[model samples]
Each structure stands twice: as C-alpha cells, then as structure tokens.
Target: MTVPATAAGRWASLWGLAIVPLLLLGAVLAYLVATGGGLKTLQGPPVEQLKVSRVTLPERGVIQVHLVNDGPQTVTVPQVMVDDAFWSFTAQPAGPIPRLGRATLTIPYPWVDGEAHKVALLTSLGTVFEAEIPVATLTPQPGRDLFVRFGLVGLYVGVVPVVLGMLWFPWMRRLSARAMNFILALTVGLLVYLAVGTYLDAQEFAAALPAFWQGTPAVLLIALLTLGVLLALGGKRQPEEAPLGLSYRIATGIGLHNLGEGLAIGAAFALGEAALGTFLILGFTLHNITEGLGIVAPVVRQKPRFIQFALLALIAGGPAILGTWLGGFAFNPVLATIFLAVGVGAIVQVVWEVGRLVARNTAALGAPLVGWSTLGGFTVGVALMYFTAFFVKF
Candidate 1:
C-alpha cells in the first residue's frame, strides 16, 4: 500500500527539521576546529635548565626572555635568574610531554643596562635548570597602564554567552525539536566534560594542599558520592512529559556547578598561580558557551518570552559572580573542593537524564542524525579540553 500524502509530508517535515540544528552545530564545530579546536599552545618548561634564546628590553622597563623546555615533564618556574641575581618570575605550568615544548617568560624591569644575566628554573627537587642570556641596553618609555586592566575586563565579558542566548532564544525556538535536541545533546556533552575536568582539577588542588590538610580528600570523596546518589534519586522522579522541565533542572544544577568553576579560576589567579589560572580560564570559557545552550534547551520546546529566557539565563549564570569572588578572595581549598564535588554530583545526575532523552528521541529521529550529533558533541568537548590544556599557559 502507498503511504498517504499527509504522512509523507509529515516525514519530510521531520527530516527538514532535523537538518537545521545539525547544520548550525556543524558550523560551530567547524569554527572550533579551524581555530585549532580553540587550543592554546603550551608554555614550555621553566628556564632553569635551559638558556635564554633571546632577550629584549623595552624602553619603558619591561624584560622579555625567550626560553625552551627540554624537560621530561612540564615544569613551572616561579622565579628567574638575572645577572646572577634572582628575580621573581611568573611562568605558566608546562604539560605532558613525551619529549619537548617551549615557553617564553616575560618580566618587568625598570632598570635598563646591557647586563649579562643567568635564568634558572628551580624545581621542588632542589635542582635548578639554569641558562644565561643577555639583556639589551635600552631606555624607558612612558606608557599607559590601564590598557591591561581594561583589556582583561573586555575579554571576561566577551566569553560570557548567557546574555546572547537569552536574547536569541525567542527566535531559536522556531526551529524543530530535532534541531533543539541536537543542541541540547551538545550542551549535555559540554557539561559532562567540564564536570569531569573540574573534578580532576579539584583533586589536583587537594593533592597540592599542605600535608596537614591532606586528609580532606577522602572525606570529600565520600561526601560527594553520597550526594550524587541522592541527586540521582531526584532526577529519576522527574516526569517524562516535562522533558524541557528536566532540562531546566539540569541547567540549574549546571549553573551551580559553573559557580564552583568560577571559584577555581578566581582562586588560582589570586594565589599567583598564573599557569593554573590560564588553563582554568580557557577550559571554563569553552565550557560556558555550551552551558548557555543548556539553559536555552528546555525552554526552546515552547518559544519563551525574551524576558523569561533572559531571566533564566541570568538565573543560571548568577552564581558565577559569587563563586569568582569567593574563590579569589577566600582562597579556601577545602571549601572549593566541597563545591566542586557538589557540582560534579549534580552534573552526573543530569548526564543520566540526557542519556535517556537521547535514547528515546533517537527512535523517532532515526539513529543517523542523533548519532552524528552525539559524536559531534562529544568531540567538541574533548577537543576543547585538549586545546585548553595545550594552550592556556598551564
């Protein structure tokens, strides 16, 4: 028997609907891939072991050193040697190296003279990686200082996507469910990736804590596991009809999670951990964009009022400000870990919900597109993580 025109039309419509979001996702992925998957080049190991390749002194009193890392593992150099005199150096963390990576160290010097200087990377093992480089004799030039501060502020605001999502969700809602689902899947992947990544960072921080505070990890792990089980129970009880509602809950949980992420970033930067701060920022920025998508996914089922959508976005994002402040100023590792674990637990609960949604939606949409979207989403998260690790000076 031949299918009716109405049925055929409906099927065609469904297919058309699915294509749009997939296309948008493809475009975003393409952009990410083109930009080296948004990865930053890793800053090489400290200058302690290696010699300076070159040195230039700015007229205004800034010193720049080009250095190489020939170490087995990435190392951080908190100080550098100049003319047999050691100067406080801020070097980002170097990374997993099968063999080699290079990093440049920049320092501010008010005095100008052609000085023969030695650079060194001091390791915890009490060994020094040392190199000698020459600083050019240069005069100082007057320059404005506020540019750095202003530039940072602009960068911070630009990375935030929630405002844009709130503004656009009304229009985005006209798209089909398949399209929305694809976006939602991508969002889910991003969150899972971030949650895992942040949790690992928290563990690292815990490990780095003073030996006297070391017992906190075991206690935190147990508490987090217990919380995860309880949150999973709540997720299990969610009604199926309100799938979008479930998305809202997940987004809310993720928003809280992002707060912890902000705290990590702020604390790292405040503590003078430049390398760690850089990595955390890059990772969190990429993660935040997908998070913006998550906030919009549930409400996309029915085109929400712009104000309502924006409100949701704000609600989801509001915690970040508080988290950042707490992390930067409070500098409490234990508290940060607790929040990190809580966020991780909540996200784990949401991931289960997303998996169920994907399974149910695939039957109607066909496995091909859903599979592609799922893979694409996963790749996006993984690539972002790698890129964050690669570049962010960490």
Candidate 2:
C-alpha cells in the first residue's frame, strides 16, 4: 500500500522540523568539545561580571546581599565598602563563585533608619559592583505578622479602593447618555495611562536584567503577544455588544495592573524602604479608585447583581495579594518584568475595547465621537492618574 501524498508530506515536514533542533544541539556540542568545554579562551583582558540581586537588613547593624556571578570567569568577593569606607564581610560558602553561582555576604554595620547607603563589592580581578539602599528599614521575613502586614497593605492599596470606586454604580445609573459617554471615554484615558506607566516600569526592571537575558526585547515581545491574544479573545463582537463581558475584561486588565502595583509595594518593603512603600500605598489607593468606575461603565445600563459586583471586585483586586507574596519572598527581576509587561498589554487591550464602547455609545446617541464631554472626561482621567502618581517614585 502506498501512503497518501498529503500524509507523506506531513511526515516529512515533521521529521525535518524535529531534525533542526538536533542539528543545532549537535553544532553546540561540537563547538564545546572542540574548545575543550570553553576552557580555551581567546586573547583578551580578564572579564568579570557580578550582579547584586538583592539587599536585605536582617537586623539592626546587619546588612546582607545576594550576589550572582554572570561572567565566564569565577568571581571572588574579597573586599566590601560601605559609605566609601572598607567594611569587613563574611560570605557564605566561602571561596570563589563559579559562573551562574550565588553567594550571600553578611556585613555588620551601623546602618541608620531613613538614611541612604551604598554597598560596593570588589572582586579579586579589580572589578567593582555596587548596590544601593535608598532608605534603611527592617526587611520583613516570612511569618504570620509579616503576612498580615502585607495583606493589609494589599487590601488598602488594591482591594478597598477599587471596591469603593465600584460603589459609584448607583449614582452612575442616573447619568444621561452624554455623561455615560464621558465615563467610558474616561475609562479609556485611565487605561492608556496605566498601559504606558506599566510598560515603562517593565522597561526599568528589564534594564536590571542580565545582558544574556535580552530583557527589553523579551518584555516587548511578550507584551505584544499578550495584547494580540487578548484582542483575539474578544472576537468580533458588535460595536455595542457584550456589556457584561466587557466589564469582566476591564476588571481583569485592572487586576493585572494592581498585581504589578502590589509587587512594587512588596519589593519596597522587602528592600527596607518602608517610607517608600507607605507612599506607594497612598498613591496607588487614590490611583485605583477610578479603576472601579471603568469596571462598571459597561454594566451601568444592565444593573448587575450584587454577586457580580463582588466577583468583579475580586477579579480586579485578588492578584495583588499574590503579587505581594511573590515580590516579598521570591522576587526576581525577570518575573517582575514579565508580569509588568503582561499588565501593560492587558491594559492597552482594555483601552482599545473601552474606546470602541465609547464610540458605539456616541454613535447611538447621534453625538460626535470626540465631543467636549468625551475630551473633558479623558483629560480628567489622565490628569487624575498623573497627579496621583507623584506619590510613587522609584
């Protein structure tokens, strides 16, 4: 029996695709063997790269740093300096750290609260790496007390404000078509700010990533992928269709943004910047209050049930708690950057959807798409977010 031409072609394609990766691996293996597992080096000056991944204050007068070796050569932490003065430090698993290895250095110094500090590490190869502490405070460890503290912070910053904003539902029911158009347009404005700000934050984290990671490109690609996927998921709805679905999508996008916010707050506290964290909480609380208005904009005509409201709040605010936990305990630059990118993408997609809704509403009411009310509402939304953002400075 002869195989069908289509089946034969499919098999050939699959086999050819499978062989590509094998060929790539074989090439790498050949290079590794030929170069004696990369031991044979070309003529060049010695290269050393180290990253101070984290700095923690375990207790008063105690400074701890986590370092990662990212270069081809082994790195040794021989000397440490604090405030431009040499300070002695003890490294766990003492000795040179091979490439991709990690080490923790413990230094005992009198670090004062609310004061800035700089810690520098000198490698044996005369290379220096620096980490900064903008404000000195105790880094909270994992415990019940810490959990409760972070939970409260997330609640105040992420959950309560969003829910409070949602309470505008009753009052929004009384608004006329023009007012509703203003609100939907305002939602678009808010989402635009969020998308831009979130992407900027992702870029900031991406800069801290190791060069090999190519963090900026990865973030951009991931964000674009996310935006495309979300847009596709929305399908081809009618211009004014899917109010309930739109509301949920808005909540989900805002939830992702809140997740990034929680991560920042948690990381700030973990890095011993309590004052900065507190200010973030205040700013984010005010910033997120408007988010609820966006969430309910579509459902304003529908009179969604109480349970729907609760679910919307939870959907929009729950990730923040999980983000705080991750940021405090297992924060990684790569992960943080990815999450921020996802948030940016989601917010951007939501902005597009909300804009469509606003346009549809305007068309239904025989008003110009970009009327005075819409422009005014958009301006108010952007201005509100921009001003509130002042309280949060990285």
Candidate 3:
C-alpha cells in the first residue's frame, strides 16, 4: 500500500494548487453572494450596444446571422429585412436579450453575388439598427474543413495526450507486472471518477429539462442501454484478453467524455460566449492528460502493434474533434445526452473490469491491499477532475 514517490508528489502538488484556491474562491463567492454583490450582476447582462454578424453556412444563398445584446436592458427583434426585401428569420429572438448573450436568426435570402446587402433589424425598443452584411464567395476546400472550423480545440484538449501516451507504450509495456497492475488500478480509479461525475452532470441537465419525465430513470436507462450496445457489439460471452478489451472500452468512454467537452466548447462559441468557450478548452485540456493514461493502462500487457495502438488512440480521441464540429454548428441536446449515456456505460463496465483484473492478478491476500494502494491515484483523479470541472460545467 506504499504510495509511489512520483505519484504522491504529483497528487500533492495538484491538490495544493487545486483545493486551496478553490476553497478561497468559494469563500469569496459566498461573501459576495451574501452581500448581494454577485447577485446583482446576475440580475442582467450589461446592455450598452447592439452587434451583428453574418454566419457562414454551406449554402451560399442562405443568409444566416445573429445579434448580440451588449447593453443592460432587453431588446427584442420583432422583424428584419435584407436589401429592402422582407426576409423571414427562421429562428428569431423569442425573448428579451440577455446582457451579453446572442440570438441566432437565419434569413434565407436569394443572395446575389458581388452585391452588398443591408440588413435592417426592427426592435421593440424603438430603435432601428441597420448593418451591412457582406456575402462571401464560397471556395470549396474538401479536406481541411474540420481543422478550419473547429481548429485544434479537440485535438489539443482530448486527443494529443492519447497520441503521446501511445508513443510511450514501449516503456509502459516494459514495466513490472506489479507496476502494470498499479497502472491498471489507477485507470479504473480515473474511470470510476468519470462515471460518477458524468452521471451527476447528466442529472444537472435533466433537472433543467421539463418536469414530465424525472430524468433520473431516463438517464439510468440510457446508460444501461449503451452498455447493452457494447455487449452486443462484442457478441461472445467473454474475450481472451479481458484487460485489453477493457482497455478499449475505457478508451471509448474517455472519447465520449472528451466529445462532450468539445461539445461544450463548440456550443459556447456558437452561442457567442467567447469567455466560456475558452474556459472549456482550457479545462478539458487538463482533464485529457490523465485521460490518456486511463486509455493506455489496461493494454500494457497486450503488446499491441503500432496500427492497433493508433486505432485505439483514434477510438479514444477522434470523437472529440467531431464533437467540436457538432457543438459549434449543430449542437443537439439529445445527441449530447446520448454521448453522455454511452460514456457512463463504458465507465461502469471499466470499473468492474478493472476490479476483476486487479483481483485476479494479485494473490488473494493482496487483492484488498492493491485496492487500497490505488486510493491515492483515485483521489488524485477526482481532485484533478474537480479542479478543471470548476471552470466548465462538464
């Protein structure tokens, strides 16, 4: 049960940096709330000016745009026009404009090329806002669309760590059996934390939903169904290398979680919340580092080929990039919940699989001891998750 020197120091430093500041921040926030200073800020967003921007979509004729309410008070967009021609907005701002939030409105115009378009926004506050929206010529770039759109947000935050971990597989495979077991145990700890955290996150979303279906049961069912899908995919009762199978399962779960993170980033930006988008990127980046270890740990004894390792990395990491794309332009709450469910199921299985692996490897007398030994790693994972999670809701 002795703690590894490296692991102990790492966790100690992380906890010190994470917990102390979080405590101080909590106290400060509490004091602010008590004094109603923070509450006043939440009353409304600063409404000073109105801003407009044209959104780029695949179709050139479609005029997609949005407005940001920069001032403190609320402004409603009743109607809009393009080039003196009445253009209907698909999704108009239904409610009052929040302090700094944006309202996306799509106006599908027969946009003429090489022509300037003027958009006149009619608001309820007796203000006529006129802005020129320039339509761009669409040049098709087939291969680089993803990188151009979502950029490296997903790769940096969710995938790069897995790539690096894959590179270190040689060293990982050289570790002693006991050390490998410890790593396996540590991976489980991380998954356990993620499984619990993801379920809580689901609850938060569900609570926000309509009162009709208490989301708890739905959430549990979604997770179990996803687990069933995984089981169905692996038709056999059991695999020869259970730990490796478990490794893939864990990687799948981590990928789904990372995708959720990417979704948060994309949705934030799509909603024109730059500050939140940046915070999501930074928070997920920290979370992904340890996640790479979790993805790689169980496969240490398998001596997987380079292509196999690459496939694992892709399985564990590619969804992050895809999620960013979906979140930015096509965020669907239903899909987000589905991914969360899949992640939960994967993690649930991993906790069990890892427990079995740890138990079977060690002598009967030492299984409990191994479990105890991994507590430090598990605590570290939870602590780190919290530290990053403080910034982003997920």
Candidate 4:
C-alpha cells in the first residue's frame, strides 16, 4: 500500500499554491507602507541621492545619460556636465521623473577620448550625482578581451566539475531507471530555485520602469512567448520518441539562465564595479556545474555519444559569452527582464517533463508522492546552490 503524506508533507503541496501569492501580497503591502502607504507625486528639490543608471553612446557626437530617481518626490535637474565641459539636453524630458523612475539626457560631445571621463548632473538646488564613463576601446586585443570577459562573465570555475561529470556520462547510462529519476527530480528542484530566484532578482530593476509597464507584465508576456515557441517547435512530436531532444530543451533553458548571469556580470563591469562582476562570475560558474548535470540527466537513458554531449554543453554555455559581450556594452532593464523571463519559462517546461518522467518511474516501484528518497533528493538539490550563493550573491 502507498503511504499518505505526513502533516508536513501535506503542507508542502499547498505551499506551491499559496506561498508566491502571499509573498507578492506581502511585498506590495510592505512597499506601500514603507513609502507612506501610497504613491506620492510631486515636483521640487528633494534631499535624495541620485544614481547614474547607465551611460551609453547613442551616436557620433552624442552621449546619453540615464539617471535613476530613487527619491520620494520628482526633482527637476537644472544642469549636467561632463568633466569640465558643459552640455545641454537636446530636448527636455517630458516631465519630472517619478520616484523609482529613470530620467534620460542626451548631450552633444565632440571628443572621442579613449580615456575615462566623468559625467555629473546638477539639480535645481545644486545637488550633484556623478559617475565615471567606461573607457573606450578602439581596437580589440583578443587575448586580453577574452581573459576579462571569461574571468568576469561566469565561464570559469564551473567548467572543472562539469567537464569531469561529462567524462563519466558513459558510466551514468548504466544506472537504473529509478536512479535516473531521482537525479531528474533533484535537477528539477535546482531549477525550481533558479526560476524563482531569477525573477526575484529582476524585480527591482523592473520597478524602475513606469508603473503600467512593469517587469511583472513583461516577464509574464515573455514567458508565455517562450513557451509558445518551444511548444510550436515540438509540434506533433512525442517526448518519448525524441529523448535526445529533451537534453536540447534543458540546455536551451540553462543557456537562457546563463545569459542572464552574463548580463549581471556585464552590467557590473560596465558600471565599473569589478568586484561585483567577479563575484557574479564565481557564483554563476558554480551554478553552471549543477546546470550541466541537469542538462545531462536525460542522457542517462538515451546513451548519447560524446560529440552530442559536447554540442549540448556548448548550446547551454555559449550564450554566456555572447551575453557578456552585449551586456558590457549595452543593457536595458526591460531587455534584462525579458531575458530572465524566457529562462524562467523554459526551465518550468523542463521541470514538467522531468516530473512526468519521475512519476512514471516511481509509480512502477509503488512509491508514494511523498517518498522520503525523492524528497531527500530534491532537498539536497536545492541545498547545493546554497554553497555557491553563500560565498557570493547570484
């Protein structure tokens, strides 16, 4: 006879239905209470620190400034300067930037100095917020560029374990179906953490946009689009017959996740925070190992060739390189949210597939839904991420 879930295990299923909504409600309420219980609209000089959100070259003879308004009231900026040179916005911004919004200024610049330059903004009351412009690189030094990008963009340390694991994939195929299912479920747990964490990380960044155009909506839209794309791609194909394809799906999801990691690294580096960039790289590298295991878990049954495994790894890992390149040069909060949403959507699909596989295997063994082994495996998978997370923020 199959055993029933215990009191604690019974609560776990409901958690899936209840926790996110409760937390979201709590977050909304906390934000309201913390900000005087409602949105405040105003215009004046305010005593709040302004931050340089991003700086970009829009065109020749032009530099664009994006200022993040973390203040309670909207404030009018009277002037902005680059180093000792004065510049004016070509066109005035529509209105005072709302709280948690970003303001943009486009200034003409005739110089193309390769050296670092500082940009400053002055409010009506003479409050100044300044940030350094990233030094321009006119020519590419391949070796140095690769070193900086890889070391800081999250492609290093994780490779060691991932490589070793793939080397042992041949032996893994010998494991029984139950063993593979345990591993599959465990991988699902790891991705469970990833999907949730990825969305949470983008929340504040998404909040910087206008209230109507928030990250939540964008994420939902992108996730749905990603799912539609995946489903469309698999039109009329059975999951069982195309077992090798499952690995590709997993890799694609992991690739999307890694691309987000690259964005973090690139954004950090672009803003001149090398330490944060390095920390992000290290954390992502560790996750990359677990991601590799998640990708290869299907191979345990399919017995894919080494060439196939290598291609899957590249499929999953190559995006990190491209993401780093783009993120360092140009990043928009909206785009970042979309990238993360895509990853979340794809990973959720993978989790569903893995769960179905696990259910079929466990049903054969007469195990309960709350079987200790499966639960233990999942808990372990979730805990594994904590090791890297503790050492550095992901």
Q: Rate the local accuracy (lDDT) of all candidates.
A: 0.58, 0.86, 0.70, 0.70
For TM-score, candidate 1 versus 4, the one ahead is 4
Global CA lDDT of candidate 4, please? 0.70
Summing lDDT over every window of 10 consecutive residues in candidate 4, give the lowest-scoring window.
Answer: 134-143
Model 3, runs deviating above 4 Å: 1-147, 207-216, 228-238, 364-371, 388-394
Lowest lDDT block of 10, candidate 3:
134-143
- Ten-residue stretch with the least lDDT total in model 1: 139-148
Best by TM-score: 2
Winner on lDDT (1 vs 2): 2
* Model 2 bad stretches (over 4 Å): 2-42, 60-62, 82-95, 108-117, 236-241
Error of 4 at 296 (Å): 1.1
TM-score of 1: 0.52
Which sections of candidate 4 miss by over 4 Å? 1-53, 56-64, 67-78, 81-154, 157-164, 210-212, 228-235
For candidate 2, write residues 120-170 as lDDT tens digits.
Answer: 999887888999998888877789988987888888888898899998999
How close is each model in CA RMSD to the real structure? 21.7, 3.6, 17.7, 13.0
Error of 4 at 165 (Å): 4.0
lDDT measured at residue 103 in model 3 versus the true structure, 0 to 100: 81
Winner by lDDT: 2
Residues 298-382, model 4: lDDT tens digits: 7676767778878887778777776776667666776777777888788878777777767777888788755886887688778
